[model samples]
Structures are given as structure tokens and as C-alpha cells.
Target: MRIRRVVLLMAVGAALAGCGADGEPIQPTMSANVGVGTSGTYGGVGVGLRRGGLGVYLGL
Candidate 1:
């Protein structure tokens, strides 16, 4: 009886695992980026917000 219970539990766990999201996980909602040139004359900063496949970014 105990062995049958164990086998049943294992099968359930496997089925649940297979039902997980099919692709890469969603990214975070907020992010920042900064860049500078070697000559010290070029630099910029950016802020962004993302949701699913949509996002917005602002840079200077």
C-alpha cells in the first residue's frame, strides 16, 4: 500500500511539473542602464518600465 501511494505521488508531481510556463519567464518591471565613452565626451542614462511584451524607455 505504501509503495503504491509513493508511485501515485510521483506521477502527480511529474504531471504538475510538465504544466509549467512554456517559454522564458517574464522580466522585471523596472530597469536602468548607463553608458560612457572612452573620450569622456559621451554619456547617457536610461530608465525603463516593462510589462509582458510591452515597455517604455527614456534616455539622456
Candidate 2:
């Protein structure tokens, strides 16, 4: 009985090990935006990740 309990607890802990803050896993993403002026056009591109209710971006 004690061995069963220990095995059950180990299984539960292994299952919970995969759990984490609710949100998508960190992943690479890209975005772009553009605008036009009377005489010219402008645009920007960025790459970053969106994870755990936060976003990071790098652009040029």
C-alpha cells in the first residue's frame, strides 16, 4: 500500500510538471505595417514573440 501511494504521488507530480502559466508557448512571430504620404510611403517590419500575456518586438 505504501509503495502504491508513493507511485501514485510520483505519477501526479510528473503530470503536473508539464503545467505552467496559462498562455501560448513562446514562439517567433513577424509583423509589418505600412502607410502612405502625399509624396512618399513608409513601412516597418518586426519580429518577436508573444507569450504569457506579454509581447516583445524588434523593428527596423
Candidate 3:
């Protein structure tokens, strides 16, 4: 059982390192973000905005 698990893990690792669809270049998405800064941050009651956008998902 342990050997089987090891083999399975190795196979998965190899698959991830290969020319999988997940390795394709993708675009960044934009969305609304609102939060507060912490830990010595200058911004207070942070009110930042971002443009809404879409992105691609290259799945394996």
C-alpha cells in the first residue's frame, strides 16, 4: 500500500511538471477589493477600488 501511494505521488508530480494545460499562460482578473490596512500600515479604513475584469482558466 505504501509503495503504491509513493508511485501514485511520483506520477502526479511528473504530470504536473510536464506540458499540462495547467501550465499554460493565463490572464489576471480584477475585482472589487475593500479592507483595512494593519500592522503599521499608513492606509486607514482602506477604501480601494479595482476595475472588474475576466480571466481564462487553463485546466489540465
> Which is superior by lDDT, 1 or 2?
2
lDDT of 2 by residue, 1-60 (tens): 655654565454444433433545555565678999998998765555555676665564
Residues 1-60, model 3: lDDT tens digits: 655654565454444435334644332322333455665433212111222342222211
Instruction: Output candidate 1 Cα RMSD.
Output: 18.2
Query: What is the lDDT of every predicted structure here?
Result: 0.46, 0.58, 0.36
Q: Residue 34 error for model 3, in Å?
A: 48
- Winner by TM-score: 2
Which segments of model 2 are wrong by more than 4 Å? Answer: 1-24
Q: Candidate 1, which ten residues in sequence have the lowest lDDT sum?
A: 23-32
| Residue 55 error, candidate 1, Å | 30
Task: Kindly list the per-residue Cα lDDT of model 1 for residues 1-60, writing each as its tens digit.
Answer: 655654565455445445434854333232335556786554333444444676545443
Please give the RMSD of candidate 2 to the true structure: 19.2
lDDT of 3 at 41: 32
Error of 1 at 3 (Å): 0.2
Q: Please give the ranking of all candidate structures by lDDT, highest first, separated by commas.
A: 2, 1, 3
